[model samples]
Target chain A: MSRPVSLPRWADLALLPVINVLVAFFVAGLVVLAIGEHPLEATRILLTGALGHGEGIGFTLYYTTNFIFSGLAVAVAFHAGLFNIGGEGQAMLGGIGAGVAALALGSLPGIVALPIAVLSAALFGAAWAAVPGWLQARRGSHVVITTIMFNFIASALLVYLLVDVFRPPTSMEPSSRIFGPGGKLPFIHELIPGLPKTPLNLSFVLALLAAALVYILIYRSRLGYAIRTVGANPTAARYGGISPERITIIAMAISGALAGLMATNEILGVQHRLINDFTGGYGFVGIAVALMGRGHPVGIILSALLFGVLYQGGTELAFDKPKITRDMIVVIQGLVILFAGALEFMFKPALARLIGGRG
Target chain B: MELIDTAIGVFASGLRLAIPLLCACLAGLYSERSGIVDIGLEGKMLAAAFGATVAALSTGSALAGLGVGIVVSVMLGLIHGFASISQRGNQIVSGMAINMLAVGLTALLGNAWFREGGRTPSLEGAARFQPIALPGAEALAGVPVIGPFYKSVVSGHPLPVYLALAAVPMTWFLLYRTRWGLRLRAVGENPAAVDTAGVSVSALRYSAVVMAGVLCGLGGTYLAVAQAAAFLPNMTAGKGFIALAALIFAKWRPVHALGACLLFGLLDAVAIRLQGVSLPGVGQVPVQAIQALPYVITVVLLAGFVGRAIPPKAVGIPYVKER
Candidate 1:
């Protein structure tokens, strides 16, 4: 089979994604117009609401932190030619791990309790992910289907644990008791007293560090080389003495570990307790983040920020224009995913031909 | 005799639940058998449910609603085909996109039109599918154990349930005993060979996908107009995914898919019944465990712990004709 001519570096890396984003926004604008709202005004309101003030910016950053963890989780797996759609389930299990750690170590200082929670989160996430990874690597079961099924199982498991096992006697709510004060991570506002109060916490810094580590691991390390090799051509990797199965398992484990950290941000940093559906589609949103970012650490960060804008800004848009609900934001996100992920190559061939003509 | 009666009642409900699942399972079967992996079955069902419900509300005709629902699902199927087949895009990504789009679009439109919080106005009597008594059901009910079984399990189901039952045999025949079915199966296994055989690979795939959409639409219509009176946000829940799992469990065979859907439906019925009941050896079986059974079983099956699952060789890979 013949392959289409590849686009130039500039078009592939920069121009195409920008064009896709524009198309997404254009479609979103049409929806807004259809609802009898001014598209330009809505865009202005969204930008201002998401980034205009310190509090909005802080909230944006806070959402971005969760996306980074889940995005990196997906990127790592994608590098091994694995689609780990189980981030939702992995993250849910991770919260239980963090919750257990916090409740057990609540009497200790935040410094002491925080590291334990983080450790448990990663451990739990990796373990949960490893099941499907092992199945895919050893038994040839498709990881995509397994991971998707795992998400539903994870939700049921979380509800069982929260309602049946972990809920405090006094509370009727389906959630565990609030963690002790020492287990709480300090919010950014506490560190910078002049800043506005937001859920933004030390986790943002942790996310940035994780992104850098992912960059080094994926682009700089020998393991990354092995992963890329397996993703690109497993037969060649097998010939080169690398076991594709082992790499698949290891890559998914790391991906799950990254996804697990999202629980730390929400449980330890924000919610202060284990709650149902606290992940709030963030894990699924990570798919869009990873796809739009092209699975690179830097790209993931940028796309994560873009989605943060959509989320925070969309909330404001819905509030300002009652006719347009928050679900419209999901529609816009879907459009972006469609253009950047599914229809990613739709425009490439045409663009290539145009570029060829220009030369 | 009393225990036997209760067993029949539970089995009846299981059959009722299996109707929607059978529709979706057949839908996924057609798509996958034609080399297109359709994870967006849930999305198509949701969109169809919303479309059907809204159309019924406006026109006051359940039949009209069913028609509109099929159109919407077919449109979604076309989008999936365009992205995965023509554009050579990632099939999974395309499916996810459709799912997300449906969730948002349905909610947005439902909220706007109904002003009832992302749900349609409930239909009364004739606006929805009412139970239809089979001919001589009353006469059959007086004939002992077999009578009650037929009365409870076969008679008085809405029209869609009967349609779903009829569809299984129709699907079986169409897939196994027809020339088009042969071409469809051949394309999924090796599109290049089909292309070499002078058949249009893309045309066959498109038709299979559209047929899948039509089946999903009927399933969605059943959910909204027959099982329930109105459309609610994400009313399909994970039934579409469960249907996909069923298709996989059945190894892409139409007849086996019917059995798989009924088995899942049975599991669901039992889970609902077992929620608070305490078993002899086990204390009240946790609701979560029963609810998680299907997924757990699917995973185990996929792991080759039970039966083997081998997808069509060319499934998920877009066909490209050699120059």
Candidate 2:
């Protein structure tokens, strides 16, 4: 017979996350020792650098925008049980398309240029991602294999475009010219003072709205029910007249377009001009975000904000402490993923008990 | 009259370029055949390359460098095995962790050691790898039609070329003719079956992954000590991923992997040569397009048109035993 969770409600799910955070601390300390640094000092500096100054807060919010978009993109695929590793390539090319549009159509009004650039990016990214989705749906090809392959092909193509076709004549940076002022996103600081560089442009709000839309689309819509059923059990879903084939295509395309939104936030909102590689592996890092969030939209946002802190704070730590490379951030990032992956072992019992159940 | 001679020279250069791919792909063949993914092959090669360069620079011995490369790889292999097999972690995650570790460690150590740049000191031609031209094959240069072709195509490659060529036969014999090979195959196909038969399933799988490390080590050392006589950061680039694609394209078979490596290598060699060689109507094709040709083809092939490619049945699935 099934049993209800017998533990006190407060001591169940809430306490478990605290313990998990402590474990993350221990793991991060181990890596610090391996790299020959004082973990406490590094952690202290990392925290201070992230929120210590006005600019630090801005950096945090800026990064949170990218994380939110990428996290949702990967989560959509994860909920569909498809591992879409091609996010980086998709987002990168998406940025390129956005950049080209922004640069070419500077004559348009600010409002029109921004939306056009973002939608163009979404369209381009969708077309690029459609190749892998088609492969999986049509030929019994594995997404893992095809996505990995597409990544290399996409990066190479981007590199070629940057060096040859799009190389700006005005600057030596391996990038196109700065998008005209008309294309610039209105910074939060520009509109309001003393906001700690929130960079609170229109796009961050859009991302929050997108998160809600994704939740509604995935959980409330009929399409959402179909996708969830397919993810839970494809065979059963198929037998019930739900088409796994069609859902795979739709879900992957949606995921890719959402990934393109990150380009909009990054290039159109914050950076204003696309560089050679604007992404610091945000697309790939989003996978970890999705996993840690349990594929929940709210959870994805929480995880995204946490990762945004790491990214922003880590960059600040790099400038302040020259001895430490940006790569240490990677070690910490990897450890976070390692623990996140192992969460089932730790959380299963606690979650079970939270509902008055016994294992 | 000299067009044929130029063509012959390019083909010779192409095979030399192909050697490292062959070595990495063959090593990939072993790991994948045993049902373990070797995405870390690039990192393994990179670490081995650094090991070889440091050894050669410090010890003045190529043989010592080769030995160091293999040992370093085995150690890295154990790291992969420790996390993936012992801790029961995900294989892809473990491989990715090692790759990240290799990237940071190689750069950190290289900077500390080099003190000038993130690159080791370059060597003289004396320290560099030399081609092992068979004497009579050199005489084939003077012969009529067949002689020039044989001399240009078959002769004048470095030791690793022959080693890479020989590894195909060695892999074939080890995979089909030996008991250890059978055990490895069993582990790849189903570790539980081997476990039921009273074998240590984890031990066998670990060995297979470790073997991949060894192969990656050799492939890497061949690049730095054998090819360039120096080391640079991220030098192996995405050849490791290319090797993985080749492994899949070959369907985890040794013979097919070798052929796939050669095919990709040839395309790579051709692309590099075709760079800056403009056609009359097209003006010029960017080197990037040519360089991207291999990966583009891999994507297209993965898009389901090139025959059929299926990975091993039990690949990337961790074997958890019944308690």
Candidate number with greatest TM-score: 1
lDDT of 2 by residue, A1-359 (tens): 22333445565445554455567658767766665667788778888877777887777777888878888888888777787877888898788888889998867888888778878888777777777877788876777667777777778788788777777776667777778876777887877766755665767877888899999989999988888888888999899999988888888888888887778777887777777677667887777677667677898898888877877777776676554556565655555555554332345355555555543
**DockQ (0 to 1) for model 2:** 0.33
Q: What TM-score do all the candidates reach, one by one?
A: 0.98, 0.87
lDDT of 2 by residue, B192-289 (tens): 88899999877887878777877887788788887887998878887888887777767677888787887777777777777778878998877777
Q: Which stretches of candidate 1 lie over 4 Å from their true place?
A: A1-3
Off by over 4 Å in 2: A1-31, A34-36, A163-174, A194-201, A342-359, B86-88, B112-117, B123-158, B190-200, B320-323
C-alpha positional error of residue B247 in candidate 1 after TM-score superposition, expressed in Å: 0.9
Where's the lowest-lDDT run of ten residues in candidate 2 chain A?
A: A1-10
TM-score of 1: 0.98
